[model samples]
Target: MKNEIDKKLTDKNIKPTAMRQLVLKVLTEQKTATSLPELELEFEKADKVTLYRTLKTFEENKLIHKIEDGTGSVKYALCQDTCECHPQDLHVHFLCDKCKKTYCLNDIPVPTINLPIDFSLESVNMVVKGVCFNCKK
Candidate 1:
């Protein structure tokens, strides 16, 4: 299951260290996107610096997307499909209010719209907050 992770890092020129592998392992095994604190708790052996750097590398390589759902906590999720990091497409992410978990809505592709020549947009992340199925039940 984690083999894909190693391959991804290798493809992106990211060296796979023990800590880096653990970070990817955590992300792939996660039920939903996670924040720094959540990840810290998830991997007790991983320090802040390591986790932060891993997240940065993953984001830079377009393997994950950041989710700032206006809740103050910065979250991250796996980039299952094409994202703006590649072609500047909008992506809508879901934030579960009850669990404070975020999930990427990969099926609903982000719409593209034309912008004025004067206005140039680099990237955008759409976030929607609500209770998840488990929380609602």
Candidate 2:
């Protein structure tokens, strides 16, 4: 597990520090997108600033992506191995109203948009809000 975590970090050109390795481990275990506050709960003794910085570094290196699911709190999820955070690489996010958990719909790619000649695409964040399968059950 440690070797895998280290490899993931190294692949993203991020040095595998203790904090980063631990944070990445937590992220890997998540079934849904995670927020800073949620991650804070995982590492009670660790400094919040350090965790935030580690997340930022991972995001900067494209190891993870951030989601703004209209809940005001930004959530982070591990990116697909081939993900480069491009427009076409973006996918729909599902925000469960009941469980309040956000999930990455990786199989559902965002539709292509036709923009004016002078315009360019930057990023797309499409969030679908509804009750998740677990919540429905």
Say which candidate scores most in TM-score.
2
Backbone clashes for every candidate come to: 0, 0
TM-score of each: 0.86, 0.98
Overall lDDT per candidate, in order of appearance: 0.78, 0.96
| Alpha-carbon deviation at 54 in model 2, angstroms | 0.3
State which candidate has the highest lDDT.
Answer: 2
**Tens-place lDDT digits, model 1, residues 11-105:** 77788888888888888887787888888898787678988998998888877778888779898887764443644444678888788777877
Clashing pairs in 1: none
Root-mean-square deviation (CA) per prediction? 2.0, 0.7
Q: What is the lDDT of residue 65 in candidate 1?
A: 77
User: What is the Cα-based lDDT of residue 59 in candidate 2?
Assistant: 98
